[model samples]
Target: MIEDWRQRRAAKRITSGDGRALKRLRWWQLPFRALFYLTLPNGDGRQTEYAVDIPRRIDSEGGKARAHLYLDGRHHAESKLPAAFPVEGGTIEMAISAFGLKRCHYVTTAGAQHRLIPDPRSAEGRRARVEREHPTLSRSISHLSALILLVGVGLNLLQLAEPMSRIPPIAESIGTFESPVRLPIWLNFALAVGAVLGSAERALRLRYGVLDRAGK
Candidate 1:
């Protein structure tokens, strides 16, 4: 029941788009921009292409970014992050995180879900290419990324727990805790940077979870 209400509310947030041609992604924009495409059959049996474009670095004056949806080659609709844009058979769901995109997928009426294809010149596209050309190496790298995030999150939780346990009431109820593993400040900073990169790599593959989101 609650999920249905949330869906209805999201549907209401979608607004029509002005028919503007999408700007080509520039070389400098590769890191800050994300473009995804989905093709589906229209009523007349011709394929209609839909594109979701997000400029991660550019924020509106209100401090929130928007995702633009283009139909064929013209602008179709747009909405804020975590948007649900209605499409031919379902909706295109878009979401972003501090590091990169957390979601860009098509959810179909029959309950199937698929990630949209990334533009060939984008970072995500290069990652996808590696996966295609070196499947084993790609899988190994992905697993390593997950491990890095797990370690980062585990250390963060331990650090948080020690501080929380120091409160007077909490200290009385349970002895103050100390993290067993401690690293130098420089190492900690390095680990933090590594964690961000790992999370970004996972985002390129559309992989996300509580830890990945929290670590970011």
Candidate 2:
């Protein structure tokens, strides 16, 4: 019931795109741009290309950032973040997080979901290339990212618990609690930086989870 309501709200947020030619991705824009593509059948045995473009570093002064949809290389429609754009078979869902995109996929009428392919020159594209060319190494890196996020989140929770336990109401009821793990300020800052990079790496692969989201 709640999902349905959220879907309707997202649908309402969409606005028609002005007719403009989609720009090509440039080298300098690789870090701040995300472009994904989907090729779907056009009923006549031909394929139609749809692209979703988002400039992560750019934002509107008064509203949420928008995701632009291009059909066959021309602007079609656009919507705010966490967009759900209706297409041939289903909806193209797009979402973003602090580090990068957390979701960009197509959900079919049959309930199956498929991720859109990133542009070959983009950062995400380079990451995807690495995965294809070096499967074992890619798997290892992915595991390391998860481990980093886990440690970061665990430390954060412990740090929070110590302060919360010191509150008068909680301390009176359950006694004072001390955190077992504590690090110097500089080391903590370093770990926080590592956590952000780890989350960004996962974002390049379109991976998201509770720990990944929390680390961001």
Candidate 3:
């Protein structure tokens, strides 16, 4: 069984074209090449260091993608890793910086190395999933607020409210605001859309990186 499993995993290869896996496929692809910078309080005034980069995505199972770690352009010795390496669940963390928006993770195990989705949604980020779920009340509120914002924006655009019908005041307000510029037509529409988007974001618990039900 073990040999069969190994053969199956090896067949998929450590990597594919660029993004490796579909989740990773982005406009910008980092080669086996991102560098991580770390400083230790060892304050020998010397910077403690290791080569860290984004984890590799490989097939852990038939056609299933997982992440694995590398260090210093090569994998590093966890044993010798200067006590300074970030540790979590017996695994160290690495981040690829060139792509400001991307994240990476890996684990070293007696069994095969494991890979994971790059963001808060990953199983490692279970807490994030909890936050996204938050509580029913909060989710409801975000949805309701979004709806109200949309309605308000609509009212502004339709000139349905007498006060909003005056363009001069609104134009002046728009010019003065640090927030979104208030255009009677498109601007209001955008705000309404934003309301929905914002609510959706909260609903997804991407806001605080946590999605959990209340009283859970």
lDDT, residue 186, model 2:
90
Task: Enumerate residue pairs that collide in model 1.
Answer: none
TM-score of each: 0.93, 0.95, 0.23
lDDT of 1 by residue, 1-216 (tens): 995686787687677989999888777887888988999999897999999998886555546778899999899987777788889999888888887888898999887999999988888888999999999999999998888888887887787788899999999998899988777888778778878988999999988898787786
Estimate, for each residue in 1-216, the C-alpha lDDT of model 3 and write its tens digit: 994464444444434223221233232433222233332233456543333333334234443223333332234432111111333323343322111213333344444333333234232233345535776755576666555555655554344444443568785665332333336677666665655444444423323221111101
Better of 1 and 3 by lDDT: 1
Evaluate residue 177 in candidate 2 and report its C-alpha lDDT on the 0 to 100 scale.
79
lDDT (Cα, 0-100) at 42 in candidate 1: 93
Candidate 1 to truth, TM:
0.93
Misplaced by over 4 Å in model 3 are 1-36, 41-45, 55-58, 61-73, 77-216
**Superposed model 2: Cα runs more than 4 Å off:** none
Model 3 deviation from native, Cα RMSD in Å: 17.4
Tens digits of lDDT, candidate 2, 71-111: 99999998889899999999999998888999999999888
Candidates' RMSD to native:
1.6, 1.3, 17.4
Q: Indicate the TM-score of model 3.
A: 0.23
Q: Which model is ahead, 2 or 3, in terms of TM-score?
A: 2
Cα lDDT, all candidates: 0.86, 0.89, 0.37
